[model samples]
Target: MDFYGIDTAPIVGVEPTDLPVIDVNDSRMDFVFLLEDDSYLHIEFQTTFKISDLERFKLYDAALYDQKKRRIYTYVVYGADINEAEEFLDHGSIQYRAHAIYMKGYDGDVIFDRLAKKIHNRETLTDEEQLQLIFLPLMHTKKEREELATDVVELAHQIEDENQRFRLIGATVGIGDKFLADSYIKKCWRC
Candidate 1:
C-alpha cells in the first residue's frame, strides 16, 4: 500500500481462522488482511500507551504464524504522542516487533493544506493522498483533530467515485474515533 510502501498485492476480505482465541472480555486485533503473496498485514491503532500491547502483539504474531504459515508484518499507528520508542520485544532468542507510525512525527497542517489545495482545484485525490486524509486525525494535536477531520471529510465528499468516497469516509471514522468525539465523527461520516 502507498501509505506504508507495501509492495505486495492484497487479498482483500481474507480472514484467518487460527488467531488467538480469547475469553469474553479480552481484546482482539484491530485489523488484519492477507496479501496476495501469502503474507499477513496486521495493523493496530493505539490512543493510549500500554505495556501490555506489545505482549498482545506477540500473541497475535504467534497465532497468525500458526494459522497461515507465512510471515506477518505488524504495524502500530499511534493517535497520541508517546515519548517511549519501545517498538520491539526480545526475550533471549525469541523476539517480536512492530513498525511504529507515530502520528506526531508528521506535520498535519502541511498535509491538510496540500489536500485542501487539491480539493480547491477540483483535482481528484491520489491513493497516497487518500491514505493521508484517513490518518490526518492522528497527525496533529488533539485540539486540531476535529478541524482537520472536518476539512478531510469535506474533501473526501468532493471525490467523484462513490466507492472511493465511501472507503475514505469509513477509514476516516475508524482512525478519527481515537481523537474525535463520537458525535463529531458521525457528523463527518454524514458529510
Candidate 2:
C-alpha cells in the first residue's frame, strides 16, 4: 500500500507464502498473498538486474497458478542501484510480464532525516513512513547502501516505541539481507 497504490483489500490468505521451491527450481520467491478478488500478489525484491530474473519470476508464478488455478500478479521491486530492469519477457508467442518498481526516484537522505526528526520528536510514524524506513537503505543515496543501512538501523533503535523499533529493525534487516553486508544485518540483530 505504501509503494504501489494497488488496493488488495481483504486479503484472503498467504498462498504458499514463501516456501523455497528447492526440490524443483532450487530457488526462493518472496512475499505472496491471496487477495479477496481471488487473485494472487507476488512481490519479489531484487538488487541487481538480469533478464533471467524475469524468467525465474515467470516460472514461480506458473507453478503457483498451476497449483491454485488463479491469476497471479508479480511485482519486482528493484533496488536503487538498478536504474532500470526488463519488465517483461517475450519468447515467441509466450509473453511474461511483471511490474517493475525502481527505488532510484526516492531520496533516501531526505527521507532519513525527516524520519529521524520525527523519531526525535517522539511522533508516531505513519504507515507509509514506516515502510519508507524499512526500504530506505535500498533507495538512492550518495552513501553506500551498507553505510546507509547502519544509519537506518541506528535510527530504528532510537525509536521510543519498542514495538515500532523492533518491527522496523526486523523489516530493514530482512530487506538488507539481500543487498547490504552481513555485518549490517548482524548489527541489526545485535540490537
Candidate 3:
C-alpha cells in the first residue's frame, strides 16, 4: 500500500468465503484483508495481462461484498507493462471497476541500490524499505529471474535481524516464484 502511496490503517487477514460464482471452480484470491475501518482490501498480482483476469476481480469483489457487506477496494498489480490504467466491466445495470498498477512504473535498480547502501551502512530497514525490497524484482526487467532472485536473496540476508531476514526471504520466495524457478528459490531460502 505504501508503495503506491495509498494510506491504510492497520489491517488483518480475512479468511476467504466460499461464494461460488460461475466457472470459478475453487479459485482462491491472491490476498485479502480487513482494514481497520471494516472495509475489504483485495489485491491480485499478475505476471501477464488476460481479459479473464478482470472478470475474476469482479467475482471476487462481488463475493466480498456479499459476505462482508462492506466497501471493497480491489487492485491488480501487473509485473508486465500494460497500456491500460484501469479496467471496467459494465453490463447494463451492473458495473465493476479495478485499479491497475504497472510494475514497470517503478525502477528496481534505484530501489536495490538504496537498499544496498542501507545494508552496507548497517542501518535497520524501515517498514516501507523492507516491503520495497521484497517487491524489488517486479520493478525492473534488466536481468533474468534467476539473476534478480539471487540478488534479492543476497540483500535479504544482509538484514541483521534473523526474524526480519527470514520474513523478507519468505516474501521474496513467494513473490519471486512467479518469475523464478522453484528449485532456485528454495536454494535461496536455504542460504
Candidate 4:
C-alpha cells in the first residue's frame, strides 16, 4: 500500500503486534489499525460485493467489543462502489458505526498529486481529523485491463492462502481481458 500521502501516523494501539492476518476464525483482523484516540480500525477488503458484508462486520465489531470493551470502528475496503452497503445504515437496530472505502482504477498521477498537496498541509488541519478519499476513476470504462490491476494488488496483499491468491489472480487477469500484462502498474509513481 502507498503511504506517501496516506496518514498512517494517526494510528496507535494496533493489536496482535504482527502483520495483518486473514484467518476469519482467528481473532486477528483482516486490517486492524488504531486511531490516535486508541479506537480500533478493522478493515475488510472485498473485490466482489456481497449483500451480507455489513452484517459480517457487525458480527466482527461485536466480537471485538465483547473481547476488549473498546469502541471499534469498521470500514469495508472494496473495489466497487455499493449502495446496498449504504442502506444498511438506514435501519435503526444496528448500533455499530461503519463506512465503506471504494477503490477504483484512475489516473494515479493526478490522485497522487492531490494527495501530496493534502499531506503537505495536513499539519494545518485540526487534531483527530483525517481525510478519507475514494479513488474512483474519473473515466470508467471496462476496456482497460491494467486499470483493474490497482484493485488486484490490494487483493494480493490481503489474501493469505496461496490457493486463494492464485484464484484471485486468475480472476483479476480475467478482468484485464486482453491488455498487455505490463500495463498493470502502481497508481502512483515515486514520491
Whose TM-score is greatest here? Answer: 2
Estimate the lDDT of model 4: 0.46
Expressed as tens digits, the lDDT of each residue in 60-154 for candidate 4 is 67766666687666766555333234525445765555665555534444543454464455422122111212222211335342443554344
Residue-wise C-alpha lDDT for candidate 3, range 32-82, written one tens digit per residue = 778888888877777777778888778878877876799888877777455
Error of 2 at 148 (Å): 1.1
**Candidate 3: where is the Cα deviation over 4 Å?**
12-26, 188-191
User: 53 in model 3: Cα distance from truth in Å?
Assistant: 0.7
lDDT of 2 by residue, 45-117 (tens): 8889887778888888887877779888888888888977888788988889898888889999999999999
Whole-model lDDT, model 1? 0.73
Note the Cα lDDT for every prediction shown: 0.73, 0.81, 0.76, 0.46
My TM-score estimates for the predictions, one after another, are: 0.79, 0.84, 0.82, 0.46
Considering only N, C-alpha and C atoms within 3 Å, which residue pairs clash in candidate 4? Answer: none
TM-score of 1: 0.79
